[model samples]
Target: MYISFLFSSFYMKTEYVVLQILVLLYDQDVLTEDAILAWAREKEGADESDKVLLQQSESFIQWLQEAEEDEEEEEE
Candidate 1:
């Protein structure tokens, strides 16, 4: 929910740029693939804004889903 608000409130001012930001954030470790996948898959308790953001991020989600996510995370 918070992630959706941040992207929608800050990034979606002029044009739809959620996909770009998602890639950047995921690459930068600001967001993990698990986190993004979980949020994107949420259905119950999601508000309209969340639904909108989820819809806007469909392509990114699809791309993430197709990628090899089998690597185990390293303990930090």
Candidate 2:
């Protein structure tokens, strides 16, 4: 992923990886909901350090799940 390679140890100061960017990418269709959910839920191919980063986005992941549920219900 671009994030893992684009950022180095020096730039991973918590603030560098804006969790909101995930939402923006989703909104823009640059990233699909399933892909983000897979990354967050299974940490499919994440390295050890990147796994920690995924943990940091836990709340956002919950929000995504809730939002998806809500949208599905609305469509029903």
Candidate 3:
């Protein structure tokens, strides 16, 4: 209950809000480094925090890549 409430609150904040936006934008093939960084900067209020978002974005991409690879391996 506590963590659920915390997560619900977190989605209301600027950083998480921006991250969600970036995720949706990426899914729609409109995401770019400049665009994501710009949003992250506006939300997080620091360039360094943009790096954190970059890392998170990269991790999400990597997970998607690995999931595809796994599916291919399973099919073969």
Top candidate (lDDT): 1
Global CA lDDT computed for model 1: 0.75
Clashes of each: 0, 0, 0
What tens-digit string does per-residue lDDT give for candidate 2 at 1-76?
7777667654555544556676678789999877888778778476787787677667777888898899999999
Instruction: Give residue 29's lDDT in candidate 2 (0 to 100).
Output: 99
> 1-76, model 3: which lDDT tens digit per residue?
9999998687557556656776788778887644654554465555674566555455555555576678889999
Better of 2 and 3 by TM-score: 2
TM for candidate 3 is 0.36
Q: Which residue window of length 10 is worst by lDDT in model 2? A: 9-18
Cα distance off (Å), candidate 1, residue 7? 18
Q: For each candidate, what is the lDDT? A: 0.75, 0.74, 0.63
**TM-score per candidate:** 0.59, 0.56, 0.36
Checking candidate 3 for backbone clashes, the offending pairs are none
lDDT of 1 by residue, 23-47 (tens): 8899899999889988877843688
On TM-score, the candidate that comes out on top is 1
Q: Which stretches of candidate 3 lie over 4 Å from their true place?
A: 1-12, 31-50
Error of 1 at 40 (Å): 0.8
